[model samples]
Target: METDSDVELAVRPAPHPWLVLREHAHLVPMISLGGALGALGRWGLAQAMPHPAGAWAWATLWTNLGGAFLLGLLMSCVLTVWAHTRYVRPLLGVGVLGGFTTFSTAELDTRGLVAAGHPGEALAYVATSVALGLVAIMLGLGLGSALLRRGRPRRVTP
Candidate 1:
């Protein structure tokens, strides 16, 4: 006999690349706009706070952590009630936040730090970035979920 999990698996449609792309076609432009804005913002910030190779890069750390938090908050709110809207996720989460958080830059920073004879700092920076980023995201998610739940009306059963 098929188990409940098996039944659910059978009932669910398997993901197809073409179908996924078609479904999200409308989001392309929204994501593109958000990405452009996000990248520009990051570039502006980096310009404002230029750091040498192998030094502590505060701007990037802040940007990534901030982006993670915002992404979490946006996702929480969207998943809770605004999930029906297609624009929000693509515009904010996939486009803005994704573009804002640069793993490539992070890798470059770490590599530079190591190459600059600051392996200890490089290790610390990487560890702290990942750990704090996760914490920030969770915190934002919790706060957003709580706020949304508070605004929702409680159900009454007779």
Candidate 2:
């Protein structure tokens, strides 16, 4: 027999490595779509935003940061609200946005930071991103949970 806490521990879900890989299975389509949208959005921004000479790279930086921040916010909403349903989290988070962003590019940026003699900045950037990203997701989950719980009408005896 298990106590409530024991049962909670027993049922605790740890993220699966294979789940990440498997998520890639569906990510192909999600990325295909999200990337197309991101590309168009980037193009529009380039045309719309003013830029300095010899700065083609600025658009990319803007796009990636914008994407990450938007992803953090959108992911929070999806994870919290729609997350009440089965398969929602994986499809959106693991599939769509996961495919949208590039970890490979992030790694490259980290390497560039080191090469640029900013190893400390690189380390701090990585740490801050990881920590903040986690916190954002957690906050989003908590908000959605509260909304869902609160939306349910409480039963009271007259």
- Per-candidate TM-scores read 0.84, 0.52
Query: Using alpha carbons, what is the TM-score of model 2?
Result: 0.52
**Model 2 clash pairs?**
none
The lDDT for every candidate, in the order shown, is: 0.88, 0.58
Off by over 4 Å in 1: 1-23, 153-158
Off by over 4 Å in 2: 1-91
Q: Give the per-residue lDDT of model 2 (tens digit) for 93-157.
A: 54455544554555566666777777886687567556665665566556656666788789999
Best by lDDT: 1
Tens-place lDDT digits, model 1, residues 53-97: 789988899889999899889979998788798688889888888
**Model 2 residue 61 CA deviation in Å:** 9.4
